[model samples]
Target: MERKALFFLDECRTVISTSIKKVLAKVGSKPVMRVNIGFSSIYVILAINAWTGEVVVSLAKRPNSESVKYFLRYFKRRVGSGRVYMVMDNYSPHKTKGTLEVCRRKGIHPVFTPPYSPELNMAEAVFKSLKNYMSNKIFYTIEDVKNCIKQFFKENKYRFNLNAITYLGLDKIEV
Candidate 1:
């Protein structure tokens, strides 16, 4: 498979929060409704391959060093022995020496998005789309929300077009 480095980023704030605070606000008297276990405050990351516009969702938690390692390992297994390049924001975990060393050992090259440009990270757009799909829908348990997420990936992963991803600055990525 052809490999290309692409911008990456994480978004933790759920769309539900925006709707509750901005769009449809609760009226007076009744208890203010909060998004239940339906949505997580956890960070979700995507490692997008620019060449094919194929996105691999990583750990759905904080952007910590351990989480980055887990993602790298997952990526390594997915693309065994194929040298690959990845682009990501300069988040603290990404910059940590341990994280860099792990990537180096795994033959994964990391590129960074330009400073202060969120629009350039196509992975962020992926999460936004996921959030848009999840907004306001209540799930009795976290597993229910997870099933929805899994379904989304299964159904739409191949449908993502390179043209739209390029618009999100994915084509700008380089080795």
Candidate 2:
């Protein structure tokens, strides 16, 4: 029997976007800085089940082989028994030997998306929707952003019910 597992794995960074209040200035609104040099971004490493809409999220300072290993280990523990195929873009970290070894130990098969083809990954659309949802709000700190992301997953994790799309000829997308 074939493995009944498929997940889209990727990392995302949420940066501060200027609020409408700054755009519609009344000529003396303290001139909101066009670029806030001190603001930091929150990094998110996530895996989403395209079929069921389940999401696993981790907050990180940066995305690298270590984080990928962490995610794979966590994922393995969460779903104890299954053969899994993780689809992701060709980020340098995902290709690292350390990350590959983690996947191997966790019984996960890594499927690489085509080069320069982020649109081919299902996680890309999910990230786009996440960005659109957060675009209007201004976050003061990275922790604040992390909280918002946690809240989003808490609310939407069970609400996904969509058909998976296939882009490449690989036998990766099957119900």
Candidate 3:
């Protein structure tokens, strides 16, 4: 195990891009209201282990205490306690007493990124890079979108290892 901790965070998308169009893209002045298609948008909570460059992606609809609890439990069971550290962003549910308490009881120490610094969240960069890689690819249906994301993860898993080990604060294990 490495001396540094893993990083954790959750990503959720809403129809909120309508208002940010001007900032997010170069578009006409008229705001195009995006219709809510009522698809089951996923919330992904991911953990990146700094030692081995393993990226774990977990899906949820809501990021509440129970969801986080389950994520942590699954993580601990898979990785074991006291072997890895966790670096995380300060989301409310992540800061919940119940969640922190569970981490403490389970021997998983959680480190946090600095306030207002998304750059420190290397996982965010992974998503941004992947999306950019997928940009302008046409997909007519929701399943297409799902498959695109799946393919992105599959294609980048090894590249993710290289980046994670070199530039993303993860260190290679010395044998």
Root-mean-square deviation of every model: 5.6, 5.1, 6.6
Candidate that beats the other on TM-score, 1 or 3, i.e. the better one: 1
lDDT of candidate 1 over 1-175, digit per residue (tens)? 6334442435444422323333454676454555654344545666766656677775465668888888788778876775676777777888899989988998888888778877766676667677777765666655566666777777895335653445665558885
Residue pairs with backbone atoms closer than 3 Å in model 2 (clashes): none
lDDT for model 3: 0.63
State TM-scores per candidate.
0.73, 0.79, 0.66
Query: Which pairs clash inside model 3?
Result: 6-85, 6-87
Per-residue lDDT value at 76 in model 2? 82
Q: Which ten residues in a row have the lowest lDDT in candidate 2?
A: 161-170
**Candidate number of the best lDDT:** 2
| Backbone clash count for every predicted candidate, in the order shown | 0, 0, 2
Model 2: residues >4 Å from true position, as ranges?
1-3, 17-38, 166-175
lDDT of 2 by residue, 1-175 (tens): 6436898889998765433332455766565444333357777888877667677778778787887889889988876777898988899999999999888888999999889987667676667767766655667777767777777777786345443644233457566
Which stretch of 10 consecutive residues in model 1 shows the poorest summed lDDT? 13-22
**Once all C-alphas are superposed, what RMSD does model 2 give against the true structure?**
5.1
Candidate 1 wrong stretches, greater than 4 Å:
1-40, 163-165, 168-175
